[model samples]
Target: MNASPEDPLSQRPSRIRVDLDRLSHNLRSIRAHVGVPVMGIVKANAYGHGLVPVARHIQAQGVEQLGVAFLEEGIVLRQAGITLPILVMGGIFGRQAVQFIEHDLEVTVSSLDKLRQIEAAAEALGRKAVIHLKIDTGMERIGVHSYSAAPFIEAAVASRWCELKGIYSHLACADDPGSPMTLQQLERFQEACAHFERIGAPMPLRHLANSGGILHFPQTHLDMVRPGIMLYGVLPDPVSRRTVDVKPVLSLTSQVIYFKVVKAGNPVSYGATWAPTRNTRVVTVPIGYGDGYPRGLSSRGQVLIRGHAYPVVGRVCMDQFMVDIGDDSAWNEDEVVLIGEQGDAAITVESLAQAAGMSAYEVLVGLNLRIPREYRYS
Candidate 1:
């Protein structure tokens, strides 16, 4: 069976299908387990799931808050009439503060210096900006130092121009079981929370869990959960060997541009990294590194055709690659899947990430906007 004839292009080839049903299922499962208000991290286009559609779907699934990485992303959601509470996870710098205040979006104040700048900006705009004081914990990337958190929290809470809506911290090693660093960071966050509560700093909502923390440590759930990859149905870490049995939502499919019978000893692809030792049927797919398929997948990548698994041959080029389709039912210049279900076989994003030496987040986020993302409800 194939796609409908009315929309030949949809059924024909060269499109990525988004499974909203799978997405909804994953959202429900995560919400049930996490047991807190989830701020669906839809930044980077919901990890390349198409921002507006995924955000709308997330809204439909009952998530009231959405998190993004930049001010522009939050603006886009606001323009789309999302109306839900959006927390800009990334710091807003320079003149972006006014836009954040105007849109009524919450932002993370990572540095006291940045907070000061924002306060000045809010005064200029004659509006109160809601901000969250971020604690560095052990990430060492952003946020105020745990020791200095007291003063920062006090200043923000007392600032008439700024509204201290919440306090948050990012976890650095929540995925690693033996990383005692998580415990140390948790203790620091707790102490900071206690300090805020004692001094009446008004840290109404406290959160510190990313996807890894939500899955591994229940105690860290606190008042909210910010999950990114897991909501899109990818495990936070592969080493833990946890499989959720949830369906993946994205399908990268293309077509076999051409088919050729190669004689023995004919080297394939650039650098001739792979050569045919025997007469083989080579199936060429029109998808490569240019489309976010990593070049590192060269000979390590796998694809499904007619319920059979075939190894990718040679180096993946910028726009094309060859697969060893072998002597199966004939293949022609038609739709072929490079990263999706083909009959009973499937190439999951996790498998592709492993083959490309990248994380699941990298694999999904690497998908360029040029690739058309088609969404379906069923």
Candidate 2:
């Protein structure tokens, strides 16, 4: 919404604003709280804030490491000249072994087959491949099960062409501070790590804490902690406590493109899902599901305009949506705050997610690359 003559606004009225200062604040807060190295998770396009920019900024903040969900995400960071220790947490295909080594990326060795693939690639190139052993304590999504991980750990520890840099496991219930499942998974992971000591092998760096763990479980903060949504100043769940002092780093805003008065009992937008009993002032915003604004927010969401909050009037369209302002005055091009503060009012990601009937993660990463992103510090 801050426009100038030289750096004018684009033809589109909606955009996502990223606060880099808030990101730095969150990183520092998490680091100080955990008292360990922080692997800033920038997966899913940095939670839809812009991948390259966010990673670049945080890397400059001197984060210890970085994590992503896919191989291509790491490759993209490398292409952008991000020279930092990046761990590709997803499973690796045999064909990607060479690419991973060439890019100087850390691989997640979830199984013996994956370890063999990396070893072969590294030996063929006469180079050492850095890897982390993944133990499946829970979240049956990936990694070798802790019950049967001894052989896999032994094989990885004996790999000649690979360097075992670290070992880790994903927490399935870390988001729920009261869930006993987290401690159970932690016990299983500790048991798996004990294998390294049992065989007289040095234990690699151990990391298991996630955002929820970072907030609630201090015991899980082993050698490092990976903070994803919390890094962006958003909680992973509705009941998540704000143990760390952090502010939102991203805000969504738009402008009123059209303004008109609707007749009494006349439906607005599609499907005639909502109408006012009396005539009212309505404004159209140039953003909708196409831009990742949830269609479920139709008539359920609220936006701040002219320092006042107004309800969405009807079904959200692909390219636009309607808002009822009643007798309040709002001219064309008036600033509209969708997920940010306007005067004394503010709309948060958690509230918006509740209105959309989606999780906080879905509300964030669901915002595709359709909307332009601008970065600021104030």
Candidate 3:
């Protein structure tokens, strides 16, 4: 059951399965929920689900735009023949402006000074740079503070070389519906947008909602919505309400490569962490921290096998980990479920994040390039 017949690489014990249909369903669901154009967040290698493939799948599904955290990510999409509008939201330096313009990627204008740098580059190239104004509402991260956004907005509007495309801000607490910070930030964003009216300039598109905002606050869905982790069927916060019915698009499964009977009181794995009080059956899974599976999950994580959940018995190794099955029977080449379902039991990314003492975002992006990913339309 661990092997994929459609994929030759599935023969490898450790592999990732991405359901493009699930991704497509999530994109449509998010758009229907927000009633606005969707900005699919495909950064962090599409949250470890493979960037180019996810981008291509989503782009064909009619998402209005794509958002990435870096210039190189946007360029990669373009190189892969992605033609949808892409905004590099990671905030750019004065130097990265040239590549942004050359690749037809959108720039995030945070300050008058930063705007000027990009303006100069666009002017030199004889191409007006398309840009989005990022206002610092309350995140206090990047962007012009809402209190002083007037001057920055004015300068961007007056710039001859930069074409202001959209104005947006990142939500810091929209994930927590009980947090007052989101409303305050939204108010600040609204006040900042009012500057266009004050100056009698055309208002650019407004977007402030992230995945949390999309689920919790409808008012934040102005001109567009950006669904990051949620687009991949994961919640920003485990407690966040699931307003949209989105299914997970990624699954990590492997085959049991080894089986043995560990004698009572015999320690296992690195650090000689734990041993069974009685003789127990154990199996080795061919994935570990080296594959971006968190080592912190050692002895704490659970995996599904043969329709039952088994605890990881000891410290996870760089390339392998052991699981205790007690009196149950298992054999070599049996399917091992890490972040997916087996029978009625499921190991979700949220549950994995909780067990690993990490955020769902981190857990997804942490599954680095070591594992090969195969896409499934079914």
Candidate 4:
């Protein structure tokens, strides 16, 4: 294994390196392709890419708005000096409505009660709360039902303290372009907007395209587009990757901190799940389920070292894991790649997700706060 005497990265066992240039490129590419304003999704710590830093980078790239799942996330961006428009996309409790106006964050009005609460808060605060009306076309998780959204829209449009800034719906199956449900949702959204026009309600900026919809359904790109995973250079599904041109922005890497020899028949890790048939070189990496590396990966995971792949031999511990590198004389401080290129070999997030029996979104967002994030550009 290649070793560096004075490499600073060798001091930390694991970290996530984020490529800002690629992130900016992806944002620009998506905007150019969609030809509309972009709302960069920065929820879940920017999907584990470091929320504030990623948001700052995206804001510098001239994105029109930022999206987060919680009101607290929007507050964080505002506290970090982000002045761009921020919309909290998740359903909110009525009590949290005041924070939206206080922080100048946009609210997602999912129900009439929530809208009334926001209006009340805005009136009491003497500030208008800008909002995006969320309609539930098929995804039953959040949003008002499309067929039942007329009153919601009318109330917001007529409210004196609420600014109806936009109307949107989540795409349930945009990853599968052939899925008829996407078309059905689109029809429902379009019809709902038409209803607003029929009643002479000022048509708010309409948006329905997410990363998947942006790639598979250009017609759904109304006034603005919200690109979440694609902004991080990951497609919502493998099939979408065939048509979307983007690059992965984050790489999980580590260094071998301990190495030893294990004798034949000796079991490894928590459950004694793996045993060596012969003498083997066992290298310990200081990362585990505690660091957001999936414990389910356990014996099924692989890591790249010195341009080759090695099997993880045991249950991934809370703060460390073991890899049997065979008899390869790999030593401490050797580079270990868990989700990035190593010489001619590489481990993509998709591969890691498959090994862990999880989705790519989970793999990315699940990366814990323990690992430091190193940012780079160019």
Global lDDT of each candidate:
0.82, 0.93, 0.92, 0.90
Task: Encode model 2's per-residue lDDT on 165-199: one tens digit a residue.
Answer: 99999999888888999999999999999999999
Question: Please, what are the lDDT tens digits per residue for candidate 1 over residues 1-378?
Answer: 123557544443566778899999988877788778888999998897899889988898899689999999999999998989899988667678888988988978988788888899889989888888899888788889887788887778778888887888998988775577877888999988788768865556888888778777777889998888888877767754343344578888887778898889999999988898899999888777887889989999987776678889999999889898777654675567777787778888888898889988899988886567788877
Summarize candidate 4's per-residue lDDT along 17-93 as a digit string, tens digits: 99999998898899889999999999999999999999999899899999999999999899999999999999999
Candidate 3 TM-score, true structure as reference: 0.97
Error of 3 at 149 (Å): 0.7
For model 2, the local distance difference test gives: 0.93
C-alpha lDDT (0 to 100) for residue 193 of candidate 4: 89
Ranking by lDDT: 2, 3, 4, 1
Stretch of 10 with least lDDT, candidate 1: 1-10
lDDT of 3 by residue, 1-378 (tens): 134576665567888899889999999899889898989999999998999999988888889999999999999889989999999998788888999999999999888889999999999999999999999998888999999999999999999999998999999999998888998999999999999999999999999999999999999999999999999999999779999999999999988999999999999998888989999999999999998899999999999999899999899898999999999999998999999888999999999999999999999999977787878986
Worst 10 residues of 4 by lDDT: 1-10
Q: Which residue runs does candidate 2 get wrong by more than 4 Å? A: 1-9
As a TM-score, model 1 comes out at: 0.94
Q: TM-score each candidate.
A: 0.94, 0.97, 0.97, 0.95
The clash number for model 3 is 0
lDDT of 1: 0.82
Instruction: Say which prediction, candidate 1 or candidate 2, comes out ahead on TM-score.
Output: 2
